[model samples]
Target: MTSEVSRRDFLKASAAGAGFVLTFRIAGGATSAAEAAGAWEPNTVFTIDPSGIITVHITKAEMGQGVGTALAQIVAEELEADWRDIRIDYPTSDPKYGLMLTGGSWSVNWTFDALSRAGAGARHLLIEAAAKHMNEPASECIAEGNRVRHLPSGKFLTYGDIVSKGLITATLSDEELKKIQLKKPAEYKVIGKWIQRLDVPEKTNGRAKFGIDRFLPGMVYAKVIYPPTRTGSKVVSVDDSEARKVKGYISTVREGDIVAVVAENYLAAVAAQGKMRVTWDKGPHANVTTDSITQDYWNKAKNDTSAPSWVDVGDADGALAKSMKTHEAAFWTDYVGHAPLEPMNCVARYQDGTFDFFSGSQFQTRAMGDLSKLFGVKPEQIRVHQQYLGGGFGRRLEPDVMLEAGLIAKAVGKPVKLIRSREDDIARDFYRSCTLQVLKGGIDSSGAVIAWKNTLVCAYPGERYGGLDKQGRDQFSLNGSDHYYDIPNQFVRAIRAETGMEVGYVRAVAPNYTFFAVETFVD
Candidate 1:
């Protein structure tokens, strides 16, 4: 939505708390902005200024998902604010935001209720203030089109007019916010209707800035020469004498098995990295191949009996055993990479005691925490200037790529832009683990599925990220196996396969493979 409000106006409104500054609590029980100044929650914080410009600061990562638009609509629908007056802003990562992550399609679903209340709360205050100004009963006043309308009097006050008069001062408590009546589904005016996506204009006009588009003055370029194995190995030696011959070549920074070749520009860095000679002690995993991983999954699925069932219903074992009509099938899926068009890139700067990361990250909170732990600094010392991502598909969730840029920047003592070549990006990607699913289905005489059994084997995606539950089960490895069918008996279990390599979540996570096995077996 287009707005005449300038950036100066937004800043002044935020500073003065001009109109209603609505704040909702985010995850991890973080307090609202009104409760504590700096202890801000990662919620939809929208400000209605004196000019009637509504600025909604969306904290979720907007990686090709219209989450920004959807969430804004949720606010506008309840606030009765005009769509054209809305403006969206992506805020940077901070402890106040509390676990800024964008994945699993959780952005809108988790925030809908909270944001609706915030908007409704602000609207309630606006109506009260408008009733006082118009000398009308608050019950008869309704908020619509960014203004308060008195039904009988046929008079209205624009949100800007009421805000400019400094009339809305009452705060909405958690209890009061809950008591406010929200709009019904049929009464929704902004949500569910197709409005122009907030990010479409900037994206279509090439004005959207991705992680790779970020640049700073005097920032050098870096290209990483990864260890021979994807899991990483120790560096044996480095002979960059030949790389010195390349034009614009700067130097090399080494951390463990990884080496970053720095140069004046990306082209120079790539050329120099190609010329440089570095030997790696590719550990035991050097011999780990796709075939080996697949075989490991097969072995685990066939023999691992101690593996616990992630989803168990009724008596699947008895049904499959007693049933005469049974079908069994095996499905295998190879490792798939999240090869987003933008590849992996980040601009990092470590100056004084602060570490700045200008990157499009899906998990900004994790990235900031990772860099803080890696550099031995407090979380407050790190700043993540979140940018738009070309695509995520679960790749940007990992902080390894961003960590490399930070490590390189700190080594050189200058702002460094690390860009990965397409080849390098694919080669070093944390691929979706190769998975094997052996499914068995038992059908009745009437051809209805009576029993279902599935044994999935794959390297746990969460194993590398410390996401495993107490029983040592990674949900990503077993998702989608628990079918939604009305089958009376179903048993789904997972056997962990040690691929000795890091695996990650891709587009649909485990469902991509799990559903294939389950549906195919039923067929």
Candidate 2:
């Protein structure tokens, strides 16, 4: 359903809730007073410069999920404009507007307000800009296409013409951010319609540029010698003297974490890399033999009393002891990957004033912050260009991949294009956190649950509530909501233990794991 929140009209919108490469922005937390008044944190930079062309900055990077197009449709609808004659651009990856991250399925959800606000605000300003040309009050004007109309006279002034006179330069206040009117669902035109994706043409016509295709004049080549395994490994030593003797081989470099090649050309880079040899300090997981992350999850699930408790309804112990039968189940899940076909790679350059970076990240703000922290530069100097992800099944947040490119660029003092091997991708993803749900439910002969006891252990990393971390967003809460099937007694206790690997959010998060355990227990 739609609201006065035209996807384009700017909304000081914030999601109090939780997309396509299949994600939505994680939209919930304690609601603040500004939020209660419908103010969302502004993340987009919408401006139509001195020229007539609209240069709206999109916050979400395209990952073949249609976010770029979907987000624009909302804005155009509010601009009451046609896509055939519009220009949209993504934010430079930096914190000025925000880094363009295409993760968390938040492309659409996150922009609800910002887009709505951007659209309504833009159109409002455009109308105001138009009204100023006509010496008419903005209230007397309504916009149609690029023209703002005076209802009484039925005459109109074109936005382009108004711009020819002068573009509006007003800024938004806290009150304006909250005060803008939004479009209701009944009136939505461009959004929620079967709008075609904009990236399709570039992809079809071969005009599209991916990270691997990023190149400029005098760009040399590189090849990374990946560690043997994913979790913990290191480069023990390297002998590159032989490579140095080869033609086209320039020089080699090594730092704290990585060691690799630098050459004059692509084939030279390849030949040089092939000639070099390296010894690695492999990790324990080097012997990783099975799809079974099952054991690790279960062992960690045992019992951690300090685990956050999300649900408790009745006296679970007493009910279970008093019940006729108890049903117990421990669900074991397999570790999964964000296995997008594109794998992982990044393009980086350290110039005089800025560290220019290009990669796929789910959190642009976080990525920029991470790089700034690493380089000891002001966040403003670093520019992150959020690009289309070939496919990001949640694998984009590994920041290590982006970091590798950044590190190499900083080390060499030249722009570097970094691409991870497929094996590099598979072996090194912040994989989906598989879990073991140890559940105990008591039931009477009447098929009524007398008590429910569920102990949960986080297999993945978690989200922050009020900037504080909690067990993977509690899934048991959904079941505990009503015990859904009228379970008279229930106690859902969760135990969270730290996984050795860095675990973070994956699709469906807690609800999927919790529901699998919950629905099975009910059945």
Candidate 3:
């Protein structure tokens, strides 16, 4: 989806200073103007006040990836604003923020150009206003150091001076915005250079806020009693009389398989949770074990030729039969957890059909949608406050913690904060799928590889989230197996083993294991 900042209502006078706001206008799927008139507020990246204070609205989560610093640099490079004068703040979950996802290393790559243009657009307007005030040609004026200078006259005006004299508001049409010029690589001053991270000082000084650190007024601490089996488990009974006797214990809530103990404080919550007794009907997956999954995948890799072909070129069987030299090998990898530094935690307040959620989510937009579905409200009714993630590693992408917090708050009719213990975090994780791969290659008399055949058996990640694509294949399950080499005869196939466990993306996802197999086989 494409989005552009609407310049029509661009400049406004702020109590702090003369503020410039860039309203993001979504192209195709945006709500109509009439619908947005009352409910929608423009999405702005940066605002400059009369005091020269610049507030940059950071849209992505900071997961030790330097995304906040990199995005700020993009704006500073083109806005001609001093980096030290800029303040970075995480934005609330809004449609205008556009895709608040932070996985696959896409934060900088996707936003670099858009943020640069936003800065350049602000700089352009500042220069235009300065040129008019000085009665000089706009062409001869250049924006630098928060000031616009005339090359010939050597006279300049500070951003504050221009705003105080009179605010000039102008809007750029969609066509004009598209035609705006961007800086070349050689003109970049902030992007390529190393700037101290904006979050480093806060983190080092122990002032950074993570999901687990989230606290709100009147919020109670809660801990869930998750079933031994994460999926297909139901709560049969709950005995909370002993838990209620614990000091500071507020209530025990049971919904589906989750039994949460709520208390006045974290320690009290933990103590009460231990005292509560819960019985679970551990459905079909109770008998599934790691050893059984490993053996099943290995067996499938050897015998399941009924699996669909991921890639096929020429006749690999015929080529391997004719070749004099052939080598075959099999590799196995076990399931692994993301193991982020902080366990899953989320704070939620549900009142009068509105829910406020606080967490460091990698997929904020998707999480908002998930909450809306659970709460049975519009997406706008849910407000997600983003925070710093202790570590993501693809784990924070799931919204399970947020959902749990919301459910507990709704059940108790009060603000609730849910913190998962280390055991709960690991036990309930949708782990990386265990994989078994077999590779066979044929070499000619000249020692050149002629034929290659690969077979993969693994638990399906698609079954956990959205199912297979239209091609009826889980691309992530068979990723990195499509070789780029010029092999005339090659075949790649994948079989989905029923491991009775959920699978998810961890780090580089399936490619991490798939590439290892391909590289080791070739070597």
Top model number, TM-score: 3
Against the reference, the lDDT scores of all candidates come to 0.79, 0.63, 0.77
lDDT of 3 by residue, 186-234 (tens): 9888889978999999999999988778888899999988787857878
> Per-residue CA lDDT of candidate 1, range 1-523, in tens?
1112233443343344322234543322424442232221223467666678887878778888788999899889998999999998877777665556677776776667777887887788889889998899999999899999999988999988876666665666678787887889999888999999999999999999998899998899999887778764888999999898889999988876668799998899989999888888888788888677776777788889899888889999999887869988888888888899998889999988898999888877667767777778888888989999888988988888778988889999899998888898898787887888888889877888889888888877675454467788877678788878999999888788876666788876345788877777766
lDDT value, candidate 3, whole model: 0.77
- Please give the distance, in angstroms, between residue 259's alpha carbon in candidate 1 and its true position after superposition: 1.0
TM-score per prediction, in order, is 0.88, 0.82, 0.90
The TM-score that candidate 1 achieves is 0.88
Highest lDDT scorer: 1
Model 2 stretches with alpha carbons more than 4 Å out: 1-44, 49-51, 98-101, 167-172, 241-247, 265-275, 283-296, 302-310, 463-488, 496-500, 509-511
Instruction: Report the lDDT of model 1 for residue 475.
Output: 70
Q: Per-residue lDDT for 165 in model 3?
A: 51
lDDT by residue (tens digit), candidate 2, 435-499: 66778888788867788887766542433211223344433223332346677677765655444
Give, for candidate 2, the lowest lDDT window spanning 10 residues.
17-26
| lDDT rank order | 1, 3, 2
State how far residue 212 of model 1 sits from its true place (Å): 1.3
